[model samples]
Target: MKQIRNFCVIAHIDHGKSTLSDRLLEYTKTIADREMQDQALDNMDLERERGITIKSHAIQMYYDRPSDGKQYTFNLIDTPGHVDFSYEVSRSIAACEGALLLVDASQGIQAQTISNLYLAIDHDLEIIPILNKVDMESAMIDEVSDQIIDLIGCEKEDIVLASGKTGLGVPDIMEAIVERIPAPEGDPGAPLQALIFDSVFNAYRGVIAYFRILNGTMRKGDLVRFVNTGKEYEADEIGVLKMTQHPKDKLEAGNVGYIITGIKESKEIKVGDTITTVERPCEKAIQGFEDVKPMVFAGIFPLDNDDFEDLRDSLEKLQLNDASLVFEPETSAALGFGFRCGFLGMLHLEIVQERLYREFDMDVITTVPNVSYNLMDKSGEEYTVRTPSELPEQHTIEMVEEPYITAQIITKPEFIGTIMTLCMEKRGTLTKQHYLTPERVELSFDLPLAEIVFDFYDRLKSVSRGYASFDYQPIEYRETDLVKLDIRLNGEPVDALSALVHRSKAEAFGRQICKKLKELLPRQQFVIAIQAAVGAKVIARETISALRKDVTAKCYGGDITRKRKLLEKQKAGKRRMRQFGKVEVPQKAFLDVLKL
Candidate 1:
């Protein structure tokens, strides 16, 4: 255990975490020369295509210490840098004893860097500050070094200046990992207590759970039990994770590896569950592991209604891999039977939708995304509303409280004016502002979660010219004047098209949706009335004219009364059709409204 070092590489997005990981792997000779690739730990195709690490990948490396000429075992976990996947980072941190806090030389310290640093501190993990991209022409080495000192309060010489692309300072980083990071402390002879941090599903091998052993040793063919499910199974295989799974007879405490129990059902293995021997189980399960809190809610419905069961199964298997995703069955008048799904953000939702299509061959339609709300009725009964259609009647509701977040934005000083204007337009109140340096500024705000759900990030990037980094955390639910805005086709309301919005912006928002619907909805035999309403009042309206058949074209040579009679008959027919005619809304219409 003294020679074992377990740590992870954490940083903001595109701050050279993966690149540095690649350099380290090469330096340690973990992969062969021909097998090397960019972002080598990111095995998923989607992750490579998007240039982001969507999943946390763990691998074992062997390094030789120069001082004592002793071989050491290093377990390195590479984590995603995006704010949406912070849960993955937390899980990785929980399984490690230290972290490499990488900062970009050009970008300095951003919002996500600060947030992830706090997570490491909360876990009591040792922090190693490293400055990456020092070889770039625009690298602000001195300024960024000072910023890192201010952030972590470490000495000047303790920070490692490295260039991931050029492979500079790679040996120094390895030496620091061996010297600075503390070894894992556990009793190998005690009862086995392993924390399952992540797992994956395979058709041929069944479910493979990746865990960190904290107490005792686990051997192959041992009778093991999952504490959460209370089910026992013989360990089919035990192995360490390299580029591939290297089968082994035993893995001792203070190491990371995988175990296969031949459990076919995905639901049987939970991500945060504990694993132990059936004969001598641990006294208690691990604590401080919290459930994932989804920031956005949307309905995921199958393109074909009969594929509902298939969708459910697909989601179940997907959930096993993505522990953050949550869903329950629901039905919509406009879209039919579907499941209301919760996601960390819009990008996470899109990635899940894309994965379902590619991995499971399940094509799905996702409704407009919205945040959950807390509602109180006149009788003092409170309800948690996820979808707009789930809101109670207007009169019966007493007060509505919406979730708010503390938004932290780090950007250049020159763009502060435009960024402040954008936030104010989104109904955000400025809470605090300070300068990290003369060139870099950090602004904090109290904003409703719903306000930033759609296009706030995109607009922030545009306004700051891609120089801004943003991060947020949920604060509390506050009372607000919220109204349910409904879209009516002809006279009936479409439950899927309803939304809960602030009263101040309801009228303008409704008008925008009404206009977008007018362009997307097709014309029918009768004129279609599209109205956006709040309770009994219609705030916006749009009409699509009918495709007339020219019923009076042949009566031009006859008496004026004949033409009048024909026109009257046509008008009556149209009125009757308008009352009973149903408007067919295309799938594009539901998705297009979110663009507004």
Candidate 2:
């Protein structure tokens, strides 16, 4: 067990963590030369196309230490760099003993880098700082090195300078992993207590759970049970993770591996649940990382309503792979059967939407994302509101509270004014401002989660010229003047278009949605009254004029009385049509309003 090293790579997005991981695999000869590829660990097609790691990947490698001339087992988990996938990172961290804190030499320290570093620290994991991309022309090695030193308070000589592209300084990193990072500690003779860090569904083989044995040992054909689910199954297969599964008869304490029990149901296996032998069960299930809290909520419905069950099955399988994704069955008046999915952020939501389409071959419609709100009704009862339609009627509400987040932004000093203005516009309160260096500044603000769910990140990047790195966590909910804005077409409400917005911006937001609907809604025979209303009062309105036939054009030689009579008849027809004519809202309009 002392000869084993379990560690993971952590970094900000695009900081070369995956690339460095590839080089590590090569240096360790885990993958043959021909099999080597960019972001090799990122196996998902969506991940490769987007040039990001959406999931954490684990693989085992054998490294021969030259100093001791001994073979060492290395369990390497490559984690995602984005904030939305931080839950994956945390799970990975819990299963490992150390982390490689990779920093982009050219970009220096970033918001996610700092955020991930704190997670590592909280886990009591050993941190090995690696300054990557040092070979690039824009690499600011000295500056970034100093920043890392100031942040972690490590010595200058301890920082490893490497380039993931050219495979430079990789040998030193491998040596550091063996020398600096501690090996896992557990009792092989004790009752089996394995922590199920992650799992994935397989069409042919059933469910494969990847776990790290904290105590005792697990062997092939052993009868095991999930502590949380209380379901028992024989271990059909047990293996260590490689480029492919390498079947093994037994996995000892301090080792990371996979177990297949032929459990076909996705819900039967839960990530973070403890797995132990039915014969010698552990005393208790391993308490894994904290529960994932979703920051954004949206409704997902199938384009073809008949695919609802398929969508549900797909989500269950997907959730097995991504434990952070949470969803519950919901219905909308306009969209019919769907689910209210809770996502970590917009990118997470988009990735899930894309994955459903690509992996499951299911067409889906995602409603505009919103943050959940808390409310107290006239009866003094508290309720959680996920959708605008869920908000109690205006007269029945006593208080509305929205989730606020403490956002940490790191950027150049010149954009400070614009960033402050942007946060203020979002009804944010500035909390702290500190200079990491003369050129770089870190600003902290408390902003509503709803405000940043839309386009706050994009705008922050644009205003900061892509120099700002943003990270946020939900804080306490506070009372606010929030209104449920409804979009009514011809006196009928479209529930999907309704949103809960801050009272101050309600009118302006309503006006914006009304204008957008006017532009996107197709013209009908009757004039469509696109009205944005609050309660019984209409705050904004736009009219889509009816398509008129040349009824007056045919009466060019008629008297003025005849023309008037024809116009009045046509108007009466339009009024009657308005009562029964249903407006066919284009799918594009529902998606486009999100941009507003």
Candidate 3:
């Protein structure tokens, strides 16, 4: 049997994990000359466009060395670097026995890098430190090495300095993996125990589950059963993928590959599930596998009710591949039927929306993201509501509770005062503060997660001139007096654009929504009334003046097509507006109101 080494690449955002993955693929000769692309492991267009690893991708590679006269198979898993999907990262780590911790040479170790490194340590994985971006002009190898040693508690000599973009030291890194990481140690004679790392859907082959062989050989036509779900199926065919380029044949014990069962749906397979033989099943599956809970949520409604089923199917397909995302049917009396989709964070929400447009080819109206709130009624019954419309009536609500987060802000010392003042203004309580470097400080605060879920990071970056880095984890829920503000245009309510805010900021929130609506929505031929009110009290009001001349005075039969096109454009523009019965609201009315 061939020896196998499994490892994952972990890093901070934009720290070259994907680029290093490409170099490793090149080193293993998995990709041909013509197939080379920058960060090939980031196969999704959305991931590449956003410059973040959204999904954890896996590949199998073969390495042969004449010096040692040995052939080895390496299973390389590239994990997402964002804090939002850290659960996915942890699962990726669980499927491997070692990790290549990539630290940017110029930027040193950031917050996410430290967080993922801790996860690796917690998993008991042997960490191979690699200093990436060494080809950069501002590369600081010594300082970064010192930081890695101090932060990760590793020796300086253990750090491998390399440039992934230039393919420098990649071969040596591969050799290090083959030499250092222990081969799969489970007994072939024991019951089959394969950890399903990931799975994908194929039209011809069905659900291809990628798993790491831990105990026994997984071959073609084996009767396998999922230990966690107690579902049994025959492994119809077994194959491995060269994720860098093409496909390969049957994979053996100790190698990472895919098994195509007759199971047609990808939902049948999940990450962290263990597959074993039915005759002699393993005692227990892997532990510590928890469902990924979404930290941010929003209402997603189709412009037309006919698109509801399409939207549901889109969300289902997306969830099949992405086990971390969650969604369900939600209905509002004013907005009709829609979905309340949960996301890892703001960036995750944006990526999902972008995918809906680009991949699913569906146009949707999304409400401002909100955190789920725990509402306590006068009878002491507790319930969770993701949208403001789902919340109980103000009179029925005895108390309002919302989630809090412990946020860490890394910024230049010059902006410490400004950041502190801003946090305080947002009702954040200072927890702790420490100097990270001579001119950098790490400030910790206990703030409402809802407050920071919006444009708080953007505002921080803007105020700090883009030199600030922030990280937050949900802390706990605290009671607060919060109210939902309903926005109206021309006397009708815009359900999709409703917002929840503290009673103190109700007027400001109303004014801000009206202002954004004016910018996003074009002026109409008739006067448009914009009004923001809480219950019966009008807090803000603005009017979009009607067009003086909406039609051409002079026209001919030949100009019919042009006139029809103009009217169509105008009608399309009106359709884009958030309409509440007789009222026509502009698109901007629903966007970035949280910025207020």
Candidate 4:
């Protein structure tokens, strides 16, 4: 049997992990000679556009060594760099025995890089430190290597300096993988045992589950049962990913690839679940795998009532590939029907929104994302609400609490004051601050998860002139005086725009919502008044001026259809606005409140 090495490529965001993977694919000729695409591993258009790997992808390649006169197969897994999908990355790590840790030569070690490195260490993977982006003029190979040594306790001599963009050190990196990273040691002769790391849906092939053969070989037509769920299926086909080129098939034991079974849904197979033959099923799967829990929740609605079913179907399809995503039918007395969608973090929420618009081709109305809250009622009954609209009345809520996070902000020393001030403004409690270098500092803060969720990172980057890196992990839930701000257009409430804010920032939030409404909603023939209130008190209000010339002066017979169409469009637009009795409030008013 051929020797196999399974490893993952890990790095901070934009640290050249994907680029490096592409070059390696080219060097190994995994793709056809004529096919040329940048970052071949980043298969999704949204992922390419955002310049981040949202999902983990696996590819297999064969390397021929002239020195040893032998061929070796390498199973390379590319993992996400964002902390929001850390759980997915961890699963990817579990399927591999080593990781190619990429660090940007110019940018040095980043927060997420350290975070992922620790995960690799926890997995007991041999680390191969690669200093990427060496083609850039600003690339500081020595400095970045030293920083890696300081942060990760790696020997400076162990760092490999190469440019992933130009295919500089890929061959050497591949050779190092075969030499340093141990080959899979499990016995293929044992009972069939494979761990499912990921699964995808195909229109013609059904569910394709990507698994790592741990202890045994799985052949085509083997009656395999999911060890965790007791569901059995016949493996119709086995295929390996040749990522260097476009993805090709036919994966084998001691390799990483996908298996096509008659199973129609990706939900039936889960990450960390084991697959084995019915005759000799494994009694236990790998431990330490936990179901991902979402931290942020938002309501997803459609502008047109006819689009509600479309939106729901789209979400269901998305959830099939993403187990971390959570959603259920939710309704507001005012907004009719929607879904309360839960995400792992702000980036997760943004990715979902982008996918809903780009992939599903659906225009979505998303409310302000909020963390789930636990509230004590006057009767001392405990209740958990994901949205403000579901919260108890202010008088009835005896105590309110929201989730908190431990945030680490890395920035230049010069902008420390601004970052601290902004954190303080968000009600952040200072925890500790340390200077990583004479010019660079790492600041820690205990802050409300809500405070950091909305554009706090953007604001920090702006204030630091894009020189700051920030990361946070959920710490705990803390008590706070939180209130649900209800937005009304004219007299009716816009449930889609309701927000939970600290009692201290209610008036400012109301004004911001009103301003956003005025900008988003077009001028109507009739006057529109947008108001934000808590209970019976009006906290902020803004007026959208009436359309000055809504009617056409000379309506020719041919222009009648055009005029009617215009009027119909205007009427349709008006329906989207919140109407309380007779008052009309534009839809923008609800959307703008969430914009930072």
Candidate 5:
């Protein structure tokens, strides 16, 4: 146990965490020199292309320290860097005794860096602050070290300097892992208790669960069962990830490994569930494990109706690996039958959408991401709406509440005014601000989740000149004067083009959406009336004129009365067609409204 160290690497998005993991794998010889690649832990193609980590990967390495000439078992779990995957980092942290708090020397502290540090602290895991990217000419190791000292209340010397890109200080990092981070604490003689931090589905191997054995030993032939599910399965194989899965005889206390159960369904082995021997099941399950609830909702529809079942199967398979993803059947007049899916955040939704197309080869159309809203009626009825189309009329609703978030943005002092203006336009209220350095500032605000779910992030990046980093946490739902703005085409409501807006800006929002719709919707033979309405009253209107033709162009010598009659006849035909014609709205129209 003393020689065994279980730890995970955590950091903000794109803070060289993946780069550090790659170097660590190389340092431990987990992968051969020929097999090494950039961001090796991010095995998914989308992950590599996007330069992000979407999954947590675990690897086992044997390091022999020269000082003691003793071999130590190192379980290094690489965590996702994006905030959407924070749940992955949380579970990885829970399954480890320490965390490698890697931060970029060039970027200093970021929005997610603070959040991840606090999560590790809350889990009571030892955090080893390491300054990375120090090999770059632009790196400011001295200044970054000072920020670390101020944040963690440690001396400058306590901060470790490393560069994953150049492989500098890699050896020191490994030695620090052995010397600074404590090994797992548990008795081998105690009842079998293991924490199933992650699980995956393999068509050939059935469900494979990766866990840290907290107590006792799990052998290859043991009969294991999940304490939460009470379903027993024969443990067919015990293995560890050495770049790839390598079979092992047994996983003992203070060690991390994977178990291959005969259970074919991945859902049978839940993340955060305890694994114990069925013959001698643990008397009590581990505490503090709770189910994950999705924080964002979006509608996903297949581009072709024939692919509906395929999309569903894809979502089910994805949910097996990602338990946080939730979905149910949904239908839309504009998009057709689809699923309303719930996700951890916007990035999660984007990844899932991309995977649906890339992995499954299914063409999908995703609606605008929306947050849950709590609504009340005059009759004291309560309801929750996940999309703008689900919102009720203003007259029937007695009170309206929206989910707000505690947002933090870190940027240069010069960009504070631009950021503040952007936030104010989104109806954000200033909470507090702190000057981190003479040239940098940290601004905090309470912003509605709806306001930022769309293009707010992109706008923030633009206004800050790509120098700002932002993060948010959901706050309580509060009462507000809100109204549902619905778009009607030719006196018929289009539920796909609806939004919930504040009463003060409802008219402006209506006008803006109407204008965008005009550009997106295709012109027809008959003029289409596009109106943005609040219940029965229309607040904004835009017209797509019918295609006009010169009716008298061929009649050069005709009477003036005959030409006028010909024009009048043409106008009457258009009026009749406008009343009865069915307009075809292109898919781009729905997308334009979502982007708006």
Candidate 6:
């Protein structure tokens, strides 16, 4: 423990956390040149393509100080840089003694950047402020350094300027990490106690748990158990990360590594659970370890009913790796068997959908995502509703409360007008605004989570010309005039197309949804009327004209009565078709509703 330095790197999305981790691994010779890969810490293709860290990763490095001829062990962990994964970031911070706060030299501070820094501070971890990407010509190194000093409330003396792309100042940054960051302290003689911060599911080897040993020593072939679940298994292997798995006979206190217990079922292991020897169980589990709570939710249905069980199995395997994802079996009247899933935010929901489609090769249709709402009846009984279709009747409710979030946006000042307009359109109230730099400004707003879950981020990017970045944290549930809006095709309401919206914007939104559906739904043999309604009252409507087949083309010459009879016969057939015809909604229409 005396020679071990346990620390993590944190930053905003695209602020070079993964790149910095790569530089550190290269400098310390943890991974060889042939073995090195792009965005090495980011194992998922979604993360590499998007240039964001979605999960936290840990690895071991040995850096020898040439000045003193002494080598130190470094357990360098990289944390996710988005607000949606803050829960994972927080837990990763808890396992470390220090963190390197990387701020992009060109972009400077951001909403998520500040939020993650505060999380490190709350854990009382020693923070090394490092300005990254200094090699770029666009980098304003001096200005960003000053911002760091002001934020830390200290006269800057030891700020490290570095670039992950060019390997500039990397040596200095490594030195600061060793000299300033304290080594982790723990008792190796105590009973076994380790914390599972993250995990992954492997089909051949079962569940592999990534953990930091907090107390005692764990070795290969030991009988261990999960403290919370009371499940025991024989440790098949023990190892530290060497850019790849490197087996070790044992792991000491304050060291990070993986334990293979041969637990094939992914559901058996849980993140934040305590792991220890079955014969040497501790008196109690560690404090401050809690399950992640999901904020936004929606129903995900497999397009083919036969694949429902396959979807369930895939989700179960996914849950073994992602502790934040929660789901329960549900059935929709129109969509048949499906699951109602709970997620941390909209991005989380999207990632889940993408993975289900790409990883499992399953065709799925997702309903509009919704934030959980609190409702009360006349009898004072309170209940939580997650789907718009689950909203109670208006006559029975006493009050409705919707979840609100604090949005933080950083963008060029010229786009301020468009952003403000967009915010107000979503019923957002501006709380504060200030200039971070001469050209870039930060805007804070208190808005409902429902507003942001759909197209808020996309519109912000469009209006800001892709120069804006956003982050948000769920605040509180506030009373609002909210109503459940249902979409009707022809004459019948579709439960899968329902949504909850503010009463003030319900009618206009209904009109917009109706119009979009009219464009997306193909013209049929009979006229189709699209209507948006609240209860029995319709607020907006759109009509799709019936397809004409030229019924009278067969008659070259005929009596007027004969022509009229042919037209009458065609009208009766159309009337009968209208009564029995069903609208076949395509998958793209379900996706277009999210944009509206």
Task: Summarize candidate 4's per-residue lDDT along 252-325 as a digit string, tens digits.
Answer: 45777777777765557776788888887766675736777788888888777788998987876677667688
Which portions of model 2 miss their true places by more than 4 Å?
551-567
lDDT for every model?
0.92, 0.93, 0.79, 0.81, 0.85, 0.87
Supply the global lDDT for candidate 4.
0.81
User: Number of backbone collisions per candidate, in order?
Assistant: 0, 0, 1, 8, 0, 0
Poorest 10 consecutive residues by lDDT, candidate 2: 587-596
lDDT of 3 at 356: 83
Put down candidate 5 lDDT per residue, 225-251, tens digits, no spaces: 899888898889998877789998887
Report the C-alpha lDDT of model 6 over 477-546, residue by residue, as the tens digit. 9998889999999888888888888898889889999999999998998999999999889999999999
> Taking the tens digit of each residue's C-alpha lDDT, what string does model 3 give over 7-101?
99999888899888888888778888698888788888888777888889988788887679888878888999887778778888888889999
- Which structure among the candidates has the greatest lDDT? 2
Candidate 2 residue 508 C-alpha distance from true site, Å: 1.7
Q: What pairs collide in candidate 2? A: none
Q: In model 5, where do residues sit more than 4 Å from their true spots?
A: 549-570
State which candidate has the highest TM-score: 2
Model 5: ten consecutive residues of lowest lDDT: 261-270
Which 10 consecutive positions of candidate 3 have the poorest summed lDDT?
Answer: 578-587
Candidate 5: clashing residue pairs, number: 0
Q: Estimate each model's TM-score.
A: 0.97, 0.97, 0.89, 0.90, 0.94, 0.96
> Rank order by TM-score, top first?
2, 1, 6, 5, 4, 3
For candidate 6, list the clashing residue pairs, or say none: none
